[model samples]
Target: MSEMEVLVEVRGTLGRLTLNRPRALNSLTAEMVRVLDRTLSRWERDPEIACVLVDGAGERGLCAGGDIRAIYDAALVGDPAPKHFWRDEYRLNTRIKRCTKPFVALMDGIVMGGGVGVSAHGSVRVVTERTRIAMPEVGIGFVPDVGGTYLLSRAPGELGTHAALTAGQLDAGDAIRCGLADHFVLSDALGTLVEDLGSASADDVDTLVRRYAQEPPPSVLDTERGWIDECYGADDVAEIVRRLQAAGVESARKAAETISAKSPTAVKVTLRALRNARGLSSLEDCLEQEYRTSCALLSSPDLVEGIRAQVVDKDRDPQWKPALLDEVGPDIVEKFFAPGDDELGLSTVRECDD
Candidate 1:
C-alpha cells in the first residue's frame, strides 16, 4: 500500500502513534483520520495494549490542525471530499473521548484546530513548554469545529469566548490553567516519560504522570480573567467589542482590533454556537452542530478569500463579506446551523457519559 501518514508501534503493553508529516506539522488529512480511528478501535480491544501514547514525529509540533488549503480547494470546486473528511474526523474526535484504553497525548509545539480534536479529549492530556495552541478558524472565515464550541462553552466565565473571538495562542501555563492540559511535562523530560509509560499499567499511568509532570510557570490568563470575563461575557459581538473599546486598556483594545480583523459572519456564528454548546449534553452533540455549520460555511464567500489571503497568497488581508458584524443578524447566523442533504452521518455515540 501507500506509505503511512502516521507511524504506529506496539511494544510490551504500550501502543505508540507518531504523526509522521513533519514537514507539514502533522496536519490531519482524510487518510490520516481514517487510519487513526481504525487503529485506535483495534488497540482498544487488544488485550496486549494497556495504554496508548501519541506524539508528533518532528520538533515543530504535534499538529497544526487540518489542512486548510485542501479544504479551500475542495470548497472551490464544490468537491464532496470536505464533508467525508469532516464527518469521519469528527467521529474520531468522539472515539478518543470514548476510548476504553488509557490514551495519553504528548502535545508539544503548536496544536490547534483538528490537532485539538486529536489531543484534547484523551484521558491524559499533556502539554510542554513549547506548546502553542488555539482554535484560530475564524480568522480564515471559518468557525471552530471538532468540538471547539464545547470547550469554549465550558471555559471559566467568558475566557473561552475571548479565545474564540481573538484566536490567541495560549502558553503552556495558560493551557493548564485554562483546563486544556492535564499535566505539564518539560519537553526535555518527554523521552523519559515515554519510557516510563511504556511499561505502565492503566492504574500506574497516573502515578507516572504525576512523577513526571513539572510545575508550570504562573499563568497570564489567570491575571487577565477579570478583563476577559467582563469584556467577552456578552453574547453579542458588537456589545463585546463596545465593552473592550470602552475598557481603554491596551490589551482590550488589541483584542478588539483582532476581532475586527476576522470575518463578521464567522464572529456572529461562533457566538451563537458557543451559546448553543453550553446546553449540549456531550461533545458529540457539539460535533453534530459543527458538522452542519462546517458544510454550510464552505459554500460562503469568506472561505475562499480567507484561505487565499492567509495561506495561498500570503496577503494577510481577507475582505470579509457583510463587512460589519451588524450586517450578520440572527437570520444569517441561523443559516449556518441548518444542513442540506448530507448530514454528519454519525450514529449516537453517547459521548457525554464519558
Candidate 2:
C-alpha cells in the first residue's frame, strides 16, 4: 500500500504527527491538510493526549511548503480546490495557535510557506541548525498566506519586510530571531528528543525541550538588521527598493536586485499585506485578509506565469504582466484586500455581524 502523506501515531500521552512525503520535501496536499486538521482536532479532544508532537519523515526537511505543482495545476484549470485547501489549512494554523494541549513542532529542516503556518504557530516550536525557513510566495506571484503576514509582521524590526520582498531563507537563529521558532535542538539529538517526548508529560514538554536545546548560532540577519530595517521600513515597495539601492551596502543592493526580479504586483501586495497584518489583533484576522488576497490572485496572469517559469517550465524567467512596480497601480493592489463573497470567516468581528 502507498504510504500515508501524514503519519499519525499515539505514543503514551504524546500524539505524534509526521509529514510523510520525503521526496517532495513533504509538501502539503489538500488531503494532507485535511488529515492534519482532523488528526489535530481529534488529539485535542482526547483527554489522554497530553501533548501533540509534529515532525516530518525522512532526512531532507519537515516540509518545503504546500504542493506548488498542485497549486499551479489548479491555477491553470481555474479550479476552486486551492481556496478550499487554504481555508482548511488556515483554520488548522489557528487551531495550532489555540490548541489546549501542548502543541510541539519539531521544525528540523526546510520549513516554508504552509510549513511555517503549521510549525510556527505551535506552542513549542523547536528548530535545529539544519532548519531553513521562509515565506517565499512573492517569488511565485503570490502573497504570503496561511497567517504568514501575522507572524512576519511581528518579527523584530523590518527583517520580516526584507524577507517578504526578497523571498530569502532564514536559518535557525534567524528563524528564532524573527519569532518563528522557540528552541534550538541539534539535528542529531532530535531522535532522543522524540523519545523523550514520548514519555514526558505535557507540563514537562517545555523543560524537556530546553534540556535538549542550545543557544542558536548568531544570526547574520540580526547583524544586518540596521540596513534591513532602514531599507524595508518604507511603506512603498518601490521606495523600499530605492532605499536598498541607495544604501551603499552590497547586501542591501543585492536585496534590491532580488526584489526587482519578483512579480511586481505580488511584491506590492505583500508589502501592503504585511503592513495591514501589523494592525490585526489576531492571526485569524490576518488569515481572513490573506484569503481575500489568495482568492484575488487566482485570476492573476502573474500567478500562472510565475509558476510556469519557476516550477513547470523551470526557465526562471517569468514574464510578469504589469512587469514594473510602477505599472502595478494602487487599484491593482487594493483589489487583493477587498471584501470577498467567499471569505474564510474565522474572525469574529466580520466588520459587525453581517
Backbone clashes under 3 angstroms, per model: 0, 0
What are the clashing pairs of model 1?
A: none
Q: Give lDDT tens digits, candidate 1, residues 1-354.
A: 134789988867889988889898999988988888888988988988999888898889999999899998999899978988998899898889888888999999999999998998898999988999899999999999998998878877887888889998988888787777889989999998888888889888878898988888777877888888999888899999999999968899999999999999999999999999999998888988999999899899998899999999998989889899988988999999986787764546454222
Per-candidate alpha-carbon RMSD to the true structure: 2.0, 2.4
Which tens-of-lDDT digit does each residue in 219-312 have in candidate 2?
A: 8999998999888889999999999999999999999999999999999999999999999999989999999999899889998899899889
Error of 1 at 215 (Å): 1.4
Q: What is the C-alpha lDDT of each candidate?
A: 0.88, 0.90
The lDDT, on a scale of 0 to 1, for candidate 2 is 0.90
Q: Look at candidate 2 and give me any clashing residue pairs.
A: none
What TM-score does structure 2 among the candidates reach? 0.97
